[model samples]
Target: MSANTEGFKTFWEQLTPERVAHIGEYYTDDAYFRDPFNEVRGLPAIRKIFDHMFVQLHEPRFTILEVVHQGDTAFFVWDFTFRMKSYKPEVVQTIHGSSHVRFASDGRVSYHRDYWDAANELYAKLPVIGALMRWLAKKMA
Candidate 1:
């Protein structure tokens, strides 16, 4: 792996609420980020997403499973694990997902997009929403 990729991996695996403030070090000032729930641009907006994650969940963390790099683009398969601060705070929830990132010339992320099945990975783990989501999925299938 390249130095940039290695640094990025280390950064994510060790991220914490306090580290959210330094997100700009890894992303360009005008970077773009998108996931199932949010799509935003710029460093401040990206910081808010990380901040919100810490606020809404307990011990939110990313475990990188695999990484592929080619030129300025990289893909990472990761598992995000956390406990919901609301309903069942004791239950640990894990979301399997992948991220596609493009690096800028300065070795910072210029664009990032995450892929994950929110319906099955997230909503299906919720209380009433989980039952409804599973039933609807079954009906559709």
Candidate 2:
């Protein structure tokens, strides 16, 4: 296992509200991170995003499925499982996605971007937007 990939696996596997302080160990000071609903630079801003996640969701977790590394860049596929705090029945939602990570010279992540289908993975799963998205998909089809 490459240093970058190993570090990523370890970091994410142990991620939690309390463990977030370790983000600096894996990400450089000037790291850039982005996903479907967020684009932020630096650790402080990135940490806020994570803090918000724990506050908004119930039992959110990520399971890495695959990892491919080449030079300084690595791609990882993962399954993100979580439930909304407001949902009573406690149905777990899973979003399968991939991430592109570029490691800095020191092996810390410098650039991180996640690739996922928002319409299908997130928006289409919402209570109101889900119905509309499904209807639109059917109509378009």
How do all models score by TM-score? 0.98, 0.95
Worst 10 residues of 1 by lDDT: 1-10
Across residues 11-46, which tens digit of lDDT does each residue of candidate 1 receive?
A: 999999888899988999999999999999999999
Clashing residue pairs in candidate 1 (N, C-alpha, C atoms within 3 angstroms) = none
User: Which pairs clash in model 2?
Assistant: none
Most accurate candidate by TM-score: 1
Q: Which ten residues in a row have the lowest lDDT in candidate 2?
A: 82-91
For residues 1-141, write the lDDT of model 2, one tens digit per residue. Answer: 697789788788668998787789889998999999999999998888998989989888989999999999999999999898875438899899999999999999999999999999988878899999999999999
In candidate 2, how many clashes are counted? 0
> RMSD in angstroms, all models?
0.7, 1.1
Runs in model 1 with CA error above 4 Å?
A: none
